[model samples]
Target: GLKGPENWGMIEELASVLGAATACSKPVSDIGWRPHSEHVGQTGKPVAANLYIAVGISGAIQHIAGINSSKVKVVINNDPEAPFFKVADYGIVGDAFDVVPRLIEKLKEFKANNA
Candidate 1:
């Protein structure tokens, strides 16, 4: 779970580098893993970012409803059958531990080269 302190720093770093807002699923918020202010779903905050990336989320109907307005949706989940993939413009079926670090590296490289 992303509630782990070890993973939280990486998530925050990635979001900071991407200049993106961070949000959490209802379950995460309800469980007190994340603050309710960051919750994104039918019962929480709505998201309409140009690019929405869902990592490790199962994409419940309420979650989908909140993020459906995003111009592009990217889903990364280890489960190939995760519902998030059905609505995603790009899908990566892999462990977040393996995928996120590589993604962060690539994004950093891109930023460095483009900057």
Candidate 2:
């Protein structure tokens, strides 16, 4: 599940900037933190996106199964040994709270410079 809904604003902003659709693990949707429509997993909606960015998700087998079709997978979690890292094309080990803000800033900077 995600760290908390408080940081979802920045997460959504970043996804918007990247033109990416947001999805979440089943638990997130089950807990009513995110809409079930946004849930992606074996029992949820299937994702075949070009890129999947998973944040704060522990990457259960069911969760990973849904996203296996993605061309690229990026995982950001505080746990270095998270199962998600095993399958991620790129893995960042850190707190999403600390990392997401910096990532949003960098993405904004890149967009400003490129635009």
Candidate 3:
């Protein structure tokens, strides 16, 4: 999967940090940058994640259907009413670019302390 090379390091770190695999939405995967296996959608691969975090995604009905079964759904988008919030167990209505980094930092800090 090649959504972007920028996040692979972080993904690798976090996967180890949380014991999770990396996945992306069809819209991002369709760009040919990401592998088909990375697609998560009603028409694509179905997922039942323990913690599904959607950042910068609009969370369309089609997309949500695939992820709705997750034990925890967290959405971060600038739009106050991105519609994803309705299905999310927790949501942050803000710029994902800003929120994601902060979240990563916090998680890293917590991981460091816990370790």
Candidate 4:
């Protein structure tokens, strides 16, 4: 959400970078760029990914209800007290715009090293 139209393209790019399947909050699916099958929210599909990275998404109890079973829950939010942090295995208190780019860079590094 932080990025402009051009950078929004990066969200798709990042999906490949992370080897992550794209999932979204309800609003994004309502607009229809992604399928409802990939939606993660109380009224949508539940995710059981090995890693769940939530950014800018506030942890409404409803959202938490969907993803609590993830093996590793990592939350990135500027607000330190966001409820998602309460259930997250790792929490990053920072702007997601900055953090996500750095995280993508680091993940690329991680993949390179592991490969």
The best candidate in terms of lDDT: 2
Ranking according to lDDT, highest score first: 2, 1, 4, 3
Point out where model 4 deviates above 4 Å: 1-7, 31-34
> What lDDT does candidate 2 reach at residue 37?
96
Which ten-residue region of model 2 has the weakest summed lDDT?
1-10
- lDDT (tens digit, per residue) of candidate 3 on 1-115: 2236575465555556677887777877787646888889898888899998887678888899888889999887888878888889999988755666677788889989999
List TM-scores for all candidates, in order.
Answer: 0.94, 0.94, 0.84, 0.83
Clash number by candidate, in order: 0, 0, 1, 0
Model 1's number of clashes is 0
Worst 10 residues of 4 by lDDT: 1-10
Candidate 2 per-residue C-alpha lDDT over 1-115 given as tens digits, one digit per residue, 9 for 90 to 100: 3467776787798698889878888988888888999999999999988989998999999999999999999999999999999999999999888888889889889989999
lDDT per model vs. reference: 0.87, 0.89, 0.77, 0.79
Q: Deviation in angstroms for 31 in model 3?
A: 1.7
Mark the regions of model 2 whose C-alpha exceeds 4 Å error after superposition.
none
Pairs with backbone N, CA or C atoms under 3 Å apart (clashes), candidate 1: none
lDDT of 1 by residue, 1-115 (tens): 3646457676777788899978989998887777999999999988999999898898999999999999999998999999999999999999888888899999999999999
By the lDDT metric, which is better: model 1 or model 2? 2
Superposed Cα deviation of residue 97, candidate 2 (Å): 0.7
Candidate 1 residue 44 C-alpha distance from true site, Å: 0.6
